[model samples]
Target: MTDVSSPIDTRWFYALVIAGICLNATGLFTPILEPDGALYACIAKTMAQTGDFVNLYAVGRDWLDKPHFPFWVTAVSYLIFGVNTFAYKFPALLFFLGGVIYTYHFVRLSYSWLTAQVASLILLTAFHGVLSNSDVRAEPYLTLLVIGPVYHFYRVFLGARFYHIVLGAFLTGCALMTKGLFVLVPIGAGLVLHWMLTNNWRELLKLRWYVAVVLSFVFTMPEIYCLYKQFDLHPEKVVFDNTNVSGIRFFFWDSQFGRFFNTGPIKGAGDKFFFVHTLLWAFLPWSLPLYIGVGNVVRSIVKRIEVPEYISLGSGLATFLMFSLSGFQLPHYLNIVFPFYAVIAAQFLVRLKPTALRRWTIAQTVIGVLLVVLIVGVLVVVQPARQGIALSLSMLIAVATFVFFRNTTLLSLVGRMVGAMLLLACMLNLFLYPTFMNYEAGLAAARYVNEQPQRAKRITALYGPSTFGESSWSYEFYVDGPTQYVRDDSVLQQLAGQRSVQVFTTNIYADSLQSRGFDVSPVAVFPYFHISQLTGDFLNYKTRTSTLKPYVLVDVRK
Candidate 1:
């Protein structure tokens, strides 16, 4: 809606983009996180090493939760980059960057160049966006796939080349493969809403639309074949305690609708307001504006106010509601719709009056300052003395950026917010995440094991109840070896007598094995953090010690 163009400073814009890229790149080398991230990374690593791209395995068992697209991408990256942390994350970061590019183009087409650049910046520096890159999950790939199809479809809607239509459909299929059929909800909802609002229902009935659907289905065949080969064709294999389960059926129904209805094997308690709270943190520095933007968009739609361009308000709202209504939900699921949120928020900021913009800028600046203070407080409380240099450098950068950008007159109010976001992201990636991951006991234990040649070569056994938990996959992945789960304590005694055994277990279990006449030499003790269930108490220094559980690695021998 802002027709006034800001003077172009191509050099500055390029510098900003480059700076954002560097910020994102900073996290690529950090240790892979646990539970989901470590699990996915291990899956990718296993796929690459085994060269069996079709069958997915977790801890040497048939894994059938997700499709193969993301793993395939990461596996290819691992092949090229040699299976390090950087390689595991490289593909997702590239896809995130692609999503950024698509976000810029999408907004530029629908709005102004200023809005486009700001939108891209907002997305690039968002908290979850940066976290997603480091953690390495399906969200990064889904984000790119979701945006690519929508952008191409919009091009076809504007009477661009017909190949764009085919491209859109193919991208849609890729998205479906990356996630599931739910990928269609946002894009389809947006298009349908746009058509209804504009009273152009005939566009939906076009022959090309049908062709696009066919193209999308055609592209999904590979996923279908893989699922069929891996699970459907072998119904005798047990999955989720049920034999004769169909992978195709799960992909089409169980993965999506079953989760929604809470009838799937994987179930969760649904909270309608889960995403509402999630967005508050996930979109950090831009959350307030996004909330206001969503409200304004809804009001405009209801009031029938004609706007020059169509935003994906329908797609975003629909997807948000759908996720909120689902029995199984996670915070990262919101990442795919972040591009739309960025565009809407950017558009709103660009149209704001100068006074209002300044107010928002002050609010954002205060939030940024609070974030920096929080980081400092955390560092002081946690006393990660080993990471002193990293903490000092990150703080210095945040301070320098704040001081330099605080007085700039050339950039708009929103641009200053971008500067704050960049600073926060730098702190998160360079200092905060690295320090937080230090408590990931699995990685720490694995690193300890890898350092000792004899211990590393020994057949590692996870003693106690099970090897699958907060730390198992991360340890297994980093050690790059097989970890057998020895459930019974008697098996540990037998294992000690036979060969050199390295057992990763809890402090209690280590004591138990010692009591049972097994020699347990404590190799390393790591403070374990269940990352997914991170809470305020867990983060606070005063409460962290109480929350931490000790994970021990022991050298077991007769």
Candidate 2:
């Protein structure tokens, strides 16, 4: 194996690490975005409050879409920190950070200290990796579960230690519980392929390998037990609008393979090239070199060149291929395998011949510059309210990038790349999201109701039959009082004996109530938009107001 041991400045590497961490941490306190983030938070909040870990509930109904592990962890966070935005996001961020540490150790064990540092920086700075921390989804949890186990399993391959196999099996069970049977594809593919390529038939036949299979299933019993109790035992429970549903069947088959074939209760249109295009941007500054590195690995393998290990290549390519062929695909789905990609990219850079190394540096430098320019252009277009703060931070990041770039080493390149993207993410977390929150009517309405002097007043949020449970989950989560959802005039009937109540609804619904001879007095109005899904018009400050719809809180005399 080729090794480039000449060290880049240590200060430069540590600075980039700190900046990447800060960028990820910036979103910890921000309000959760609507639809998914809020929905997940609400489910976890329900779990924590009810102390029922067996069944998952959302919008007052039994939810079956995801496995219970991520919610379980989030529920624990809510128990410790209280049910709030920070509590919701804290655990996910910690899991991703754990993935970062695992990445460093895995590469260091497989290669060298210098190579490991580069791999750590690459994984930490990956665009989607950082974004996942803010989004706070199952992906963050998978980030740690997938890589950490692979590290231990690789150790097992080195010597087939009993404890190592046990550790690997444990994490594999957790990964299964977290996502589904599909996660094993990456973990198994990496190790299986490495054994095949190295012609290690003896390792494949080891007794411990069979023991691992049994222990993995043993560790997964919790998820299985929960699913069996919740769905398999109660066939009368309606899930996905169908009766006699089995959660065990869904967990093993429908949730993973059903989605792969687009035959599940939920489906998405697939594109063979979706991830091919996604990684081009999702991997950001590292994407170009990663592609080149992957191609080189394939070429070297074909030519019978001696390489240290095939774990990273086998794991990454197999998972990438599977995702590309699957009928369901999402950009974030690729995040589970990014650690392998980082290791591969780092190894390629470390082993580069000097002439090619200089070329790689130039390409990375140009990518960094373009990244900064693009971010600056976004800030210009958005013209966020926190313009002064965003401008000052951008300038400071610029100064830091220039200082790091002066060194002309691989570590310096890592610093420059991280610094550039750090500015972009910092602007997003600090400026754009804060401004977007201003337009999140649900959060605003919740705050308004919480501040009312009449704290004991009943809170009812109106939703039409079409929008029934689609009502803002964040509003339900953040409000101080339990929120009742009423579909129509039934709200009036439900509040018959009550003297006064506050209703949250869109302007159209508010108008309908007044037209029906009900005395409705508007308490507060908020501009409403889907904060997670941004459009060009909504990002433009001048055009933003025009794009917003109105949501209102009103007092209705009962």
Candidate 3:
């Protein structure tokens, strides 16, 4: 590594650290006017508007797609920031910061200060961080929880500082609160793997992992009670087969393991390579390093390094492999692995000299700027959107760009990687995010629904985003009203046998509704989407632009 680990090097290193993180926050945080963020926003707004925080609501009913921690955070943010996009992003920021700070400290314990800085930067700006910031979801918060336990345990595991172990357990509990049991998967896998690989089962006996288990459960009790009180206590008031749904049961059994087994609410075909490829974008600048790190660890195992340093690499690979093998996968699932990568990458990067770091910085900067240009270029050319660019085929370009970081300057790979991420973030917020997010048709359709001349007490979707669950929560978001969810079975059913329904959907769904003799007209229109895996593929009959041309207004109240 470089002499940059000297006193002056520490100063310059921290300077880069602060600069990298802040630049990332500023550049990547330009919120897109996408409905997904707004979907969360609207739910939080409903909580604030109606003074009901006990349960989540969408289109004026219980929304079960996600648990409530993210909602609580957003609701509190709405209360403080008064309902803005940044408010939705605020908690995620705190969680991500937790990941960065913990990684910084954790890496410092294992490697030189310079490497620690690079690793922290990787955690903040790399794959998961970039896209995660844009979408503002529950994953970022969960990432912090996932890392906290492992980081603390690493300290305890290596140094016998038992205090960190308790703290880690508490953070693991918080991760449970943030999203459920996922907080434990990484920590548990890492610990078991570390023990087996290092032949240190004797060390494991003394750490009192049971104390952690107890404390994490103790900390998680309130969340469990709240979930039970809402879902189990009041079953009839629930929807989506609410009578059979048990929130507590989900916490203990279904939400975690069932999903892995394809028995949960979200089921999909698994690709063993899903995570391998998703990591290309989800774990950015560090993606390549992790590639090297994983390979190195396997090689070390083959060579039988028999060292603790090699064990760290093994622990990382353990978590990575477990997540990959699980039946369920999402791009952001690999986020927690960054801390492991950070430690390894820091070891690799800080070993370089100052001049090498400088060249690394320039290379990273060049790659990042090029990424921004590509993303911006796509928004300009294909699927132009406004408010913030909505998710697009264009964004697939940005995803591809992050993968290219693997090829940039290897000398100070961390610097170049961080540099590219920082640049990409700047370009997105300053130049692109604001332009592309508006293509999401849900918000526009919601707005139009809210502005009906003679406001109705209820709204419906005959064929799209039934009620406000998916496409049009913005209607309730903008309107002084609540929406009702209803799906039409026979669009042209006889009026004498039909119930008059006030429906909102893409213009295409309206045609079938028109045949059923409802008073249908164009209420509003916005962009639409068709994803085969996203549940939207059922609406494959229409193009987003075509369906979005006119959101159908139907008076199905027979």
Candidate 4:
């Protein structure tokens, strides 16, 4: 751990401050329809095409499940950037930037600049961040905005400026609009625990506190009103109570709390061990030290000791417990909270005893190396035959690198090894992983259809979700002509009525289409079929196995 020698001064803050910004910008210019990037990008595109932001439509229907903040951001970006991969993912980069800047400020103000730098590094490199990758929306933006109030509240309590309270409340309202009712468990629980445990009873009735809550609701009224107008105001046309019932009420009430208590729109099937286990992989390399730091806090809390430890410990406990209790658990949920905890964890490292540092470094290095090896092995197995030779050579090099790292007789060298492994993971993301594994073939296939002058393919359609998002949409937008998304045998025959129109579908579904009409030939099977990274990086990065590669050109015509 670096000492506080320079970090406390303005020189340290100014000298290396832009590192996160530059690193974030490094990958920004490429890929838009990422991490559900295309989905939101389409919404923004649709908005630009139709000139409507209030009525969110996708592939010709109202798209629910997520709030409007992301679409709003993308829609605006589309107007400026003009709809491309970079434009599509623009919002994510911005929000991610927000998270980085805020995280640095919070750490420096609450802890120290050196601690802030270390914590920022942890945030930048976590595998979880890599998984969600990028998409501009409430999730990423809120990840940044969430700490505003929490951070300011801490500053206020320490008897600092009152203006920050207003700023925090304003940001809280914005976050609520971004994603409704998510803060109750994390922020609410942390605050309550803080007040109760600290016996700060008088602070509870502070007028400014109540005022802040009111201001948050007021600032966020537009989004809330939009929901009410669409669902509640028009019960007949907009809202329907089918088996999949419109739980507008539940979306507000049961969706969040129901899961919190394991009751409403979703069930509480999640295990208490879920997050604890998830963190081991999601926040890798940093996870080991964080565990020790939080563990120490837990022991101290049990004995009702360690006043200074309470803030970080209480925060970690509240966040971990919130996820543990919820039925709907995902990795990114931990992202917003981990920055605070990373500071706590970083503090532990900075204040480490020599022997403790040595042991911790060794464990992290071993775990890091093993994890990388396992990941590479999986990649090797899934590699296309074309990539097999390249993968083999790379693995041999990685093996040599691994062996060299293992001979860590020196303690300082061991810590450096963990850092080296971190860089390896980053390099893997930047170069190797993109080449060997990618879901962008859907996009590639989309382009291929556009370039053909013959119109040899009449019916253009997507085999699956990859089709629904940018792939099929891109096919429709640019693929020589209008391409409709297809699902079954009947559409295949209609599209191909007399002329031979090309079609695509999931391998299993494509079989049925062949039975009904013309010729079903395999053109290009994306054997390593997977949905676009647009969704996977953020939504379900871990569920890497279930991907869809529609064997291309499998169709039936005349």
lDDT of 3 by residue, 1-558 (tens): 232453224654575577566655663345434456657778788888677877777755566666677787778877898765677777777778877787777666655565666667667777567667667767778767776787787777777677887898888877787666765666677677777787877865763788878888898887777778877787676556547577788777677777678787666666778877887766665555567656655676788864345434655666667666767777766666667776775565555456765665565556555666665554445433341433433355345435644443432355445555655565556554443335445555555555665653444543553444445654545544455444545542343145555666666677765666555655455555421122222222233344334455555543
For residue 162, give model 2's deviation from the true position in Å: 1.2
In Å, residue 517's CA in model 3 sits off its true spot by 3.0
lDDT of 4 by residue, 1-558 (tens): 233423434443342334334434434543443335555666677777677777666665555555666677777877887766667665776776677677777766656556676666666655565445442344567666676677776677778787877887777876776666766445555665667777886878888778777877787777666666555555454322233334256446765677678766445467778998888877766777788878776666678774342555666677788777777776667776766676666776666666765676677666766766665555554443345554554466456546544543332322333343444444444444454335554555656665676543455656553345534453443344445666545665676777666665556656755565557766655433333433432223355445445445554555
Pairs that clash in candidate 1: none
The positional error of residue 75 in candidate 2, measured at the CA in angstroms, is 1.1
lDDT of each: 0.81, 0.84, 0.62, 0.59
Q: What is the lDDT of residue 501 in candidate 4?
A: 67
Give candidate 2's TM-score. Answer: 0.95
Question: How far out, in Å, is residue 159 in model 1?
Answer: 0.7
Please give, for residues 1-558, the per-residue lDDT of candidate 2 as tens digits: 768586556776677778888888888988888878888988898899999999998767788988999999999999999999899998998888898999998887768888888898899889988888887789989988999889988887776567988888998899999999999988888888888888885777888888888999899999999999989999999899899999999999999899999999989899999999999999987898799889888888899887877889999999999999999988899899999999999988888776777777778888888887877778888898878878888989888787757655676677778888888789888888888888878887788777776853565655443474323687888887877666667666567446656777888888888887778888889899887779999988889888999988887774
What are the models' TM-scores?
Answer: 0.93, 0.95, 0.79, 0.78
Lowest lDDT block of 10, candidate 1: 407-416
In model 4, what lDDT does residue 118 have?
63
Stretches > 4 Å off in candidate 1:
386-395, 406-412, 464-467, 486-497, 510-523, 535-544, 556-558
Candidate number that wins on lDDT, 1 or 3:
1
Q: Model 2, residue 537: displacement in angstroms?
A: 0.7
Please rank every candidate by lDDT, starting with the best: 2, 1, 3, 4
Off by over 4 Å in 3: 1-11, 26-38, 63-65, 158-163, 196-199, 234-242, 306-315, 352-373, 376-380, 383-416, 446-469, 478-480, 488-503, 530-558
Error of 4 at 214 (Å): 1.5
Model 4 clash number: 13
lDDT of 1 by residue, 134-248 (tens): 7788998888898888899888888899999888988898898888989998778887788888888899889988898899999999999999999989989999989999999
